[model samples]
Target: MVDTALFTIRDERLSLILTRRKDPPFEGLLALPGGFVHAQEDADAEAAVRRVIRGKIGFDAPYLEQLYTFSGAARDPRGWSVSVVYYALVPWPLLEKNTSVELCPADELPALPFDHHQIVAKAVERLRGKATYSSLPAFLLPGEFTMNDLHRIYQQTIGARLDKASFRHKILEQDIIEEIPSRFRTGAHRPAQLYRLSSKTLTAFERKI
Candidate 1:
């Protein structure tokens, strides 16, 4: 089995997708998007997961990373089962575009089937653990946004408010984001400049950002 813990931001809140299962073993209950491996059609594990997510959600996430492996004799009712889990960061706009799925608050997920509750908890842990020192939260935003916008999402991801000056200083010092040539308008206020991730991958610093 392959399951994807896909997360997105809405109204400055971090949330993950959960679909109601219509099949046996947990019909009518909420669960993560997943399915069995298509060994004959998929070339590899990553491809299998990509297929599972796309088939289930009708959208592809930008950042897909392996979370962990879950296997046990009784984890699933169908004999001994193994599930390869992946965690992803999806752009909020894309999530908005896809209306078939439901976004559950990452911290307040309801009861889930099998080991899905554990899977979501781990995915949240991974996101929050790397949020402070990396550019992981940027994937939750659009291609262009303001420093204040970035700060708000980061605070939502980490569940802690950050000082404006301190947050701006850390982001600029690391140089992970580049300011755009254009500015965004806020009603009755000065136009704020937009920024986006400066590179393809996030770089780790000697000290946490």
Candidate 2:
């Protein structure tokens, strides 16, 4: 089986997408989006996961990475099974209108079946660890956003407050985002310049924030 732990920042909270199973052995229970790998169609585990996400979520995830493999006889109810897990990040707006799935807080998920909870925990740990020195958290934001928006996302995903000035300088120095020739006005403050990622790829830094 191929499973995905899809994450997003919704209402300033880091949340994950889960769907209810319609069939057994865990019928009517919430679980990560997953399906059995198609032996003839899927070229690789990654491609299998991509097909699963598109079929379930109605869109392709902007950021997807192989997380870990979990295998054991006790993990599944039907004999022994191995699950190749992947973690994905998408902007909230892409999933806000999708009623087929549930968005739950990543840190407070309920007891899940088939070792899914353990998989989610591992994925969260990986995301938080990567956010400290890479542009991984930015995938949670929309295509066009302000520097402040990016800063808040990093803080939320990393689960800590950051020095605003330091973060700004460090991110700017990385040169990963470019000005969008637009501005966003928040209440009485001056319009903040809008920016977009320079490349649709992850950026790793030499030092942690």
TM-score of each: 0.94, 0.97
Off by over 4 Å in 2: 183-187
What are the C-alpha RMSDs, in order, of all predicted structures?
A: 1.5, 1.1
Q: Rate the local accuracy (lDDT) of all candidates.
A: 0.84, 0.93
Which tens-of-lDDT digit does each residue in 23-125 have in candidate 1?
A: 9998998889888888799887789989978876676677788999999987888788888899988877876666678888887888889989889889889
Which is the leading candidate under TM-score?
Answer: 2
| TM-score for candidate 1 | 0.94
Off by over 4 Å in 1: none
- The CA lDDT at 117 in model 1 is 86
